[model samples]
Target: MTSPGSIRRIRRIDLRRSALTGGPVDYRRAVPRAEFDVEAAVDIVKPITDAVRERGVEAILEFNARFDGVEQTEIRVPVEVLHRALEKLAPEIRAALEESIARLRATCQAELETDAVTELGPGARVTHRKVPVGRVGLYVPGGLAPLVSSVVMNVVPAQVAGVESIALASPPQKEFGGLPHPSILAACALLGVEEVYAVGGAQAIAMFAYGVEASATTEGCERVDLVTGPGNIYVVTAKRVLKGQVGIDSEAGPTEIAILADDTADAAYVAADLISQAEHDPLAAAVLVTSSERLADEVEAELDKQVSVTKHAERIGISLSGSQSGIVLVDDVEQGIDVVNAYAAEHLEIHTQNPDVAASRIRNAGAIFVGPHAPVSLGDYCAGSNHVLPTGGCACHSSGLSVRAFTKSVHVVDYSREGLAAVRDHVVTLAEAEDLPGHGAAVSVRFSEPSPVESGETTP
Candidate 1:
């Protein structure tokens, strides 16, 4: 396998000199195609999902042994273990988690919307009421890095939306005796999430979509109404295939960052942010769309200096050199903005003379970090913003995971006798126009007056 340290060169694009139009600057040269083919992945994971659906927990345990290299006697984590993990958590880490929960809670509360009632006319009204999903499954990745913070991001919003039943799943750790990372368990405990599983990847999602049978002390896993959180392509693929069976947040692909900067931006700060996101994975994208060539050159040198000493230096190097990661030189900040919007990065940072002004014009991005003081890393952990966002250009249409993702919007219509009479003719006309006589008959019968019963005495 090629190591990250050997990767030394990152590509650069000069849009100002090229014949590229802002209309559709082909990103084939700049953006790397995702490694996972959802179509092919569908075939690969179909059997696994089928097995889970057929055999339930038995198939889950078998897959766990075959893939994760861990044999679980019991998949469901016990309540006492969760509490113990929290008690043993580091004091500083515990404090930080508490703060994150507080911020997310406060923000989520503000996002909670009330039912909206619209008065079409007297005695005729329509209501848009928001209701929480009954149950949810949160998947936290245990590969590459143990994402303990994801626990807070996924659970808090669901809790705020008042989801009654919440279950969490993470890949079991061999070093930790077939349980998820201790920190993951601890975060779950802190969030008061009692149900957790030692399953990961497609199998974990499968287990959530199709409830597993009761095996050992683990009560049978109940199928969730919705699943939310970021995961690998397989996890994403499972969500895609099982979308109707259960709702999903988004098909989150590889993480990415795009920084729009100018001459006034700090090269060191820009370089550090790019390196920070690159540390995520070899496929992670770190893009720099800047108006200043001097700034780009300086940032490149800064990336070289910064990537060398990082703990995940090899991974960072590979990511920076990948086609997906590069610097794009635009004619000016206006052109740079156009490129960033087209790229639609998952995390977009503005480091220009007037970052707020520049940020205001951005049409698409999962999250915008304004000014040099704000970084994507802060949003990932504690920016009071949900980091579970749309990825792989999905930000153009979809939104980041939030309270809205967990709730369903339903419209309630009410009409009185007078209201029905007023619109009865319109409804009948439309229904007849569509050649659906049954629809018109149903409405016409409601308006039809009952025949007067024959009385013994004649009307006076």
Candidate 2:
């Protein structure tokens, strides 16, 4: 618990103007964000990836000893170890994880895409196919928290997408005798994932990108087609370095939550939600955008009351007071919507007169939580929505992890002789217009000669 005198203050940004004296407001600049520089970390992580590429599992073992301070002899966890972890898991926690898995599995099944065919002409048709990646590497962080829920979030989607192979990696915990946290292992067992590794940091990304060979004491890990999940700076930097070698979900940064509340919103709920995200990391962002000044004042007071007794008071206090966390005072709900869209938080909550209306207008945000009952914490675990999301205004262009991320879209074309004839002149004319006669020749050569079979002639 934090003492009253030591409590940090959350700053305010006033966006309400007396008169219309502006062109389009640059709401992006008005919002606060943490200084997350993945480029700066390239030099530190590149060496680790390069070593893993060159030395294989040997490099991973060396790094595990150096960085994680766990003298690990093997990289992969045995099958019996996974089963033992599950056997030892508490009944209540196991029940909760099972429920979360069921809900997420249902949602992923609903979101799975299917093939679609289109006929452009009498004999020409195209089929759009949804194909799953051959294999995927799911990285779960072991820092601060065990993140057992991450196992469910990453595995269920890849399974739903029908990925043939799935591998998971987490940092080796010294306290857990050089294996991943028992809870994470248990979740993996419950999800029926057999390939698990006790590796972490950028090396895990490199191991997935460049497959390691079998060593004296360890069975090597096979390369994966794609990698997904969240991590810290080193993990994000490694993804950037090895992006072309393998597919990556997103360069996830610190967690963040923004609440767009009005006078109708409850102050206690808003404050508690803000504190919940803050508990994730000291750098996590918690922003409040509202039209009611009185509500703002009440929420601030409620935060003080709540933070004084929370278990993670120091961490929550640091996050709430950081420059990345603050309150934005907008003139009204419309202006509030504009502000939140430009900010593009990872998680956005709408607590207004009509949460549905406010949520509909939101153009950005990795995920939107509507009404008082739908808190960001619910989405983090049991809301059936993915907890892995885009951060640092990335929602403006990217999206959260889902079954779609693990699948690829391919177009298959089928055409007959008559179909080619139907568009021969058009293809030739367009190819000639582009000054590439070879393109036209490829289509022209197919029809230049008639086959005996097509002419219905018999050879003696």
Best by lDDT: 2
Candidate 1 C-alpha lDDT tens digits along 1-460: 1234467666788787465656765643354433546777898888998899999888888999998899878899989999999999999999999999999899999999999999888878899999999999999999999999999999999999999999999999999999999999999999999999999999999999988889765667999999998898889999998888888999998899999999999999999998889888988988889889899889988887787788998988888888678888888899888888888889999998999999999989999999999999999888899999888888889999899999999999998766777888999899999999899898887657642432244456
**How good is model 2 by TM-score?**
0.97
> Would you list the C-alpha lDDT of every candidate in the order shown?
0.88, 0.94
Q: Ten-residue segment with the worst summed lDDT in candidate 1?
A: 450-459
* lDDT, candidate 2, 360-393, per-residue tens: 9998999999999999999999999999999999
Q: Spell out the clash pairs found in candidate 1.
A: none
- The most accurate candidate by TM-score is 2
